[model samples]
Target: MPSALLPIIAWDYQFAPNAQKSRNYLYITHTPFKICEQPFLLPRPALLSLGITYRRVPVLSIGKDVFCDNASFLDAMQELLEREGEGRALKRGGADRAFEAWGYRSFWVALASVPAGLVSKELGEDRRELFRRF
Candidate 1:
């Protein structure tokens, strides 16, 4: 019997480290939450159900409380833990991973079009190759 919370994720084909972090943070915290994944251009029911003004990745809902925003998710966790004097610490606090963007367009948008892979599959082969370097 785990405490349940709704986690709305932006599941788009484009690969965004920032977006990945949005979902990764939740997994790292080991929080029990129900994931509500959304596709590109925003999904309807989720927006309507949550009354989302700006549909983005990682919308969270607890009972009747609906919260939409990635930057504030961590704050919400801390607030919840404070009620019980508990807190969660990220395990890979010092993990070393890097990203580099050369030229104007980072290419994330281009590679996203490739098929097969989640991000590439969504974005198309021609476009994926164009942004492969980034």
Candidate 2:
């Protein structure tokens, strides 16, 4: 069985937002797989072993096939579950479809489109300052 690796990192920061999404997909689809909570920093030997170039969390592994990142991972999951006609969430009118449809637009909008006043109000000055630096 393939294992979904989630890096145990802070959610508020921008780098590894895919862990939560990947975790939710696995749960919703009831995919039988192992969860490997890994460190937030340091190179992941597991990922390197799989020959996945992107050193990021939420990598899905099935034998030699490694789906790196949320988009690819979710797509792989959809294919795997849908091919057998299992995992209704990957079927028509599913939440997974809706979520993938939205993609990163909502995230970027939430961060970028707002006025400085609005962003500061919503995220607090300190967090907004950090984001600004990034």
| Per-model TM values vs. the true structure | 0.48, 0.54
Candidate number with greatest TM-score: 2
For residues 32-87, what per-residue lDDT tens digits would candidate 2 score against the true structure? 55666555543556555546546446666654565656667667667666765644
What lDDT does the true structure give each of the candidates? 0.49, 0.56
Report model 2's TM-score to 2 decimal places.
0.54
**CA shift at 82, candidate 2, in angstroms?**
1.9
Which pairs clash inside model 1?
112-123, 113-123, 113-124, 114-120, 114-121, 114-124
State the lDDT of candidate 1 residue by residue for 11-89, as single tens digits.
3223444456555665666666555555554344756665575544455555556556544655555455455344564
For model 1, the stretches where C-alpha displacement exceeds 4 angstroms are: 1-19, 86-134
Question: In order, what is each prediction's RMSD in angstroms?
Answer: 7.4, 7.3
